[model samples]
Target: MEIFKVEKATLSSVDDLKAYHAHIRPFVLQRLEEFRETWERGDEAVFEELVFCILTAGASALMGLRGVEALRPVLWSATAEEIAQRIHFHLYPAARAQYIVAVREVVRNELGGRLKAWIESWRGRDTRRDACVQKFKGIGYKEASHFLRNISFRGYAILDKHILRSLHAFGVIDSDRPPSTRNRYLAIEQRYLTFAHQVGIDPDELDLTLWASRTGMIVK
Candidate 1:
């Protein structure tokens, strides 16, 4: 099957964000507002944002937040190694300690023993989204999407189960199997980018809105 390139659209300001929000369902619009509020509050530090993304990968936002809350004490009072140890122990009971450790190592190595440095490096990178994601540990397409969407990376689209289902239902893509590999995910990502352009919204913003709507946290 051939996938054609989707023409990109431009959105330049807050007014653009609001206008795009208005075109979505009320539930989706409400969630976009909520996500924008929450995302704006914690986007000050890129490393912290990435760490939050790592912790939340494969988990719902609420669940990820709980994990972040659990690690906050260590984040405040301990070194990175100490924080890693505490998180390793804390998540051990949940059987996800290894993945957490993997992510910690990736961040540590990529940042050159300093979290701040890693953030700087990430912000400086000019590679494609998938290439950037490949540099991180335990971060495949889905995890990468979760991380990128939260940070509002331009032109990136997330492909979680709900989003995939929604896309299929809307006839945006025809697929029987879920996106479980890099190539498959990229294909779906292309579809999502097309849908976003057609709907006149940023792909990442659209993802946030969809997540919020599906999770039922779209406030009136």
Candidate 2:
């Protein structure tokens, strides 16, 4: 991790981000530690995190958290229709429900209840992310990166609109528009990584900081 100097900021947004980050740094660090601890809690816990990412497809992070909370009882046991019935808050509840059920079945029957082993077997973060995108129905680049980040992977940019807007505002990226393709996402992700290095923020920490600036909370 390259460290950059954080002298007095010329940009007010950047200055405000730094100020807010300082105030919530400890809390944010704690949340990240919890995310890391999820890996040790076994397959069920890891799958819960994956379900959270699935629920976040077209919904807010808060909604994702709520969906996971709502579905926790039958997440591994419920049918798609049952899952959809429980998903009242998500934008595309039915679609996300189908995705969750299908992915869970694949993990259990085909992968032998070893989702973590399968994920770790992929080698690097990008390769693992790509493998996820290729294997899962509802997972795109953003969702895959989000899942990896929640599971304690570092430096993978979860390029949601809030983070994109921050990058554009700070001139790290040219536009706030979400990337439309794998190549474009990777290109923007590279820009984000470079900006994180230049601004002296860990890419993961900057993700939550920018997200909290918009949503007022630093969640998974």
- Which candidate leads the pack in lDDT? 2
Cα TM-score of candidate 1: 0.65
Ten contiguous residues with the weakest lDDT in model 2 = 1-10
* Candidate 2 off by > 4 Å: 1-13
Residue 119 of model 1 has an lDDT of 36
Model 1 residue 216 distance off true place after TM-score fit, in angstroms: 1.7
Tens digit of lDDT per residue, candidate 2, span 1-220? 1112223222356667778678667767887888788888888888899999999888877788889989999998988888988996678888999999889988989899998999999997789999999988889999999998888877899999888887888888888999999999999999999988877888888887777776666677
Worst 10 residues of 1 by lDDT: 1-10
lDDT of 1 by residue, 76-114 (tens): 345545555555534332434445555556655554545
